[model samples]
Target: MTTILKPLALAATMTLAFAAPALAQDAQPQAPSQAPAEDKTPVTPEAWAVHLQVTDILQHYPAFHSAFQGPNSFRPQATTGNTVDATLYAGVKPWAGGEIWGNLEMYQGYAPNNTLGAAGYVNGDGAKVGRSHPYARIARLFIRQTFDLGGEADDQEADLNALGRRRTKDRVVLTAGKLNATDVFDTNKYAHDPRQDFLNWSLITAGSFDYAADAWGYTYGAAAEWYRGDWAWRAGVFDLSIVPNNAVLTSDFSQFQVIGEAERRFTLGGRPGAVRLAGFVTRGGMGRYDDATALALATGKPADAALVRHYRSRPGAYLNVEQEVADGVGLFGRLGWADGTYEAYEYTDIDRTAQAGVSVSGERWGRKGDTVAAAVVVNDLSSAGERYLNAGGLGILIGDGRLPHPGAERILETYYSLGFAKGMTFSLDNQLIQNPAYNRDRGPVDVVSLRLHLER
Candidate 1:
């Protein structure tokens, strides 16, 4: 605990020192609103936007009694881990209907025990590849080209991936380069963005929709979106890792994934709402759980997913919805399922998942810039997948050596974020997990986290 406190204190001190001047400038508080309305005027074509954000998260678990533990099991002893990330979003409108953007991120830290032993790991920001020291990488470098059709125009907010501009309601957008598949598919405004919203992996997105990516959750891909009136459709194809769960991506497209999504926008009770149905198909050399288990039984050795690998196709699908229930409250839900027979390629080890949650702004409580959210997720595996784990086969994120008694891994997470200063927020988060890694004989783990975020 002392070691954990040291890093936390150091981080806080550094952050405050850097933010003090900014805080002083904001001492003259202004009236609170749901959100500051954006200026409708479009920026110049040559204009550029530069934004930076930093996030630090510290997580700990209390000692819990365990009947049994294994190589990949969550240890009974108390454990703590932290992650810090800083990203720079830079974009420019190089020409009419075109924007070029790039994102560079510096990441430092690791997940708990390198992100093992839980279907819904506690931190969505925890990269798949853990590092002890800070490192820089290009998270996204892409070009977007939009073509307008005759229709009414809408103002696009300036955000991480969008330029501040106006575009027709009916348009076609093409994006090509390095990016995340989820950036355009299965998105839920209330539950995504770990830096500001939910932190659990299962809550951030459908736990079972195994979109393709490298270890850091980004891949080389191209996506096209066609928007007409209140409906939009998108499709993309991306490269998979050279090997399942590996850090390197395959350049030759020997292994690839195809994704499609349809979205509909509507107004319910005068509040905006959206529903999206997304599906993905991966064609690659993959292994089957039943085959892995059988090989281990025949050879009297530990189950190895690689020994039974063959080129095949895996498929998954999910539904996403987010609706504004009130001026400051919104609801979100997701339902997902995948081919349980095949081993998971990316993301976690759940074959089936469901989630529901709500996010509320603090305006109702007079803390207009604050936010609070709660969500619950249930993740399960097929009988064959359970057997593979029982035989000591590892999937993407979880395998507890054995599964004598298997049950769906259930998690409930909640968080409250307070805006203490301009562009700075502090959050306290908690999650209760049961049947971790689908092993019923194991524990119900309790995890608590403190998060600090700064943006400019």
Candidate 2:
């Protein structure tokens, strides 16, 4: 990974050096009278905007014990791994109420356990990219058109995926092309961004939803949203990968998924809050746990999901809620359920899950720009799923040698972010895992991580 990061660092430095001179040439001191009347208003005309972000995460784990291990079990040896992901976001307003955007991203590295064991996997970003050297891909390429209704307008802030613009309180937005489902559904303000918030997979999104995507979690999809006052409705359709957890997506539309979500915003005790209800249904070729287990029993061999593969529909649902509890403190929770009869196609091996957590800003401690967050997640599989695991069936990321005493996988994650310089921040994260991969015999494990992030 160092081989890849060196050139990227040099590129970043050269970009800054060139940008400084151009910015200096474009700068002009304005007189008091020449200044805009409203300091908060958007001064730049609707045009092109750019965003860049880079993150590096290093994770380490101490050795732990297990009665037995399988082909895909997490290693019980002290190990350390690192990952880096950098993205360039570019957007342009082509016409009234329309904007086109694209993101070119580079990713490298892998998790110490090859991203296995706990249902709420410890490293979200690392889990997305497989074990490999740095490689570039088009993460997002989409166009958005917003139609305004007769209502007051609000100023939109320029952020990672958005450009500074004004839109009416009531509007309709249509987006099409390749992107991520989470960017439009089941969003929680306190725990969605792995780059800045919770680093666990389950904390960022519904662990059981199993949205359609390739190895890196991006898919071809289109979404439509209607926003009115304090309510919003969203729906989308995306293509599924050719096979479960495969690296390549299907070219045809035979395998796909449909997702829908509804959101409501309100104020509780003068504090803002939001609730989102989301669900998804996928049509694809998948295996049934019961069938696989039965086949293994009849043949006196290890369970093989491939032998029971069939085309079917699987559905899942989850509810997300977040609220600002105080000046710099917030709370969030999620409850999710999925069709446990079928093997997990994407995401983790979770049939039922529940998680909740809190995030606090450093203002309380006089740091002002730092944050602290913690969450607890519990995940379980269905009886058939458990039986298949006991029969030595391997799912996407987890399966121990055996499960004589099956138990729910429980995880606790906490992190603290310290901002010591402009455009840079460092975070210390820790995770505790119990009953990893549903094997009670395997003991609890401890994993720690350090992350550094820069944005411009």
Candidate 3:
């Protein structure tokens, strides 16, 4: 994996101190309406809402980390890795109907793995060096147009006077071109920030499997949303749009591909605060780890490896509610679950795993942006009885050595953020991961990380 970052993307990351914000643009899809609204919001100029936004984040992650097994330990290795990331965001939406968004992200002396601290960032000669950090990680550009297609969250029937936001009533809403959606758990993600969410001490970018995190590194895509209220829906087809290098402006998706998702939102909550529930399914370009491995063995390189771009599918559901639980605190939670293989590689390391979790977010101690929360996630796959842990080289095998422990693997987290001056933020986390099938009584791995986030 290349560890160098682009400097242009980095410069862009630093100059957004006074930008404006237009955060409400990302909205959820709703079902059809049952009643004709006595009052309606039209698409006419008089009813259009214009919003603009600018948001940037800079995060530093410096840690003293170690991994060591006894003499019999699979792998006893220790090292320290420190990385600096800067992300930039800017967008404008002249009206509710259309908008444009862009981003740039850069990294500094980025290194891979948690070395015991020998190399901050090693060069070709394996010598640790400074002053070579760069300007561009990657850049992304996109535009989208939305049309009210069908229904409102409260209506189960059709209403002609109502404007559709998702898949509504006869009207077809389409979003064409390139784009990326901010839908992950970490708010500071999308770009590079040490404070952003982590998976096993690695940036969720670990999901990058290989791709680097970018400010606007997201490529473009086109989608269509059709609705009339009750049965209308939304779906889109898009490309990774990622290129080889932005300097040449290469539009090659050599690794480029397509993806899509469909969903239905319904009301099942009857309690006063109950709002709506959504069940969604997705299908598209997905890769596989084993396949990539095989391709590597066959072709001798990743770029040459034939990706298992199967028409993979994933289905999940989510529910959101808001209510006050105490004098100064309000409680809101979202519960979601999804089942599917993200790529062909997923099937080998994991079959059909259940991805489910819940988050509790509420206001904190009489302060703003100052909030506290807790969350737990469970991901489990029915192993065909295969478990293998190849740490230092020796393999610990159990069953067929193909599956995770017989239960769900989990990650639990809690945090408090004082969204205050100089953008001060602090969080501490303890992560425990265990799988009997894989590790076979090794131990429940525990990791603790502290983050201090700042933004100007």
Ten consecutive residues with minimal summed lDDT in candidate 2?
Answer: 14-23
Candidate 1 per-residue C-alpha lDDT over 351-377 given as tens digits, one digit per residue, 9 for 90 to 100: 999998777777665788888777778
lDDT of 3 by residue, 201-260 (tens): 122211111121122334445556555543334454333322211212214433333323
In model 1, the runs with Cα more than 4 Å from the true position are: 1-46
lDDT of 2 by residue, 21-80 (tens): 434533555456875587556434457889899999999888888888887777888878
Task: For each candidate in the order shown, give its overall lDDT on alpha carbons.
Answer: 0.85, 0.83, 0.32
**Per-model tally of clashing residue pairs:** 0, 0, 55
Which of candidates 1 and 3 is the stronger one according to lDDT?
A: 1
Candidate 1 residue 449 C-alpha distance from true site, Å: 0.7
List the candidates' TM-scores in order.
Answer: 0.90, 0.90, 0.50
- Superposed on all Cα atoms, the candidates' RMSDs to the truth, in angstroms, are 7.9, 10.2, 13.3
Error of 2 at 336 (Å): 0.3
Segments in model 3 whose C-alpha atoms lie over 4 Å from true places? 1-80, 93-96, 109-132, 148-178, 181-217, 225-232, 240-364, 382-408, 436-438, 441-443, 454-456
Q: Could you tell me which residue pairs clash in candidate 1?
A: none
Candidate 2 versus truth, CA RMSD in Å, comes to: 10.2
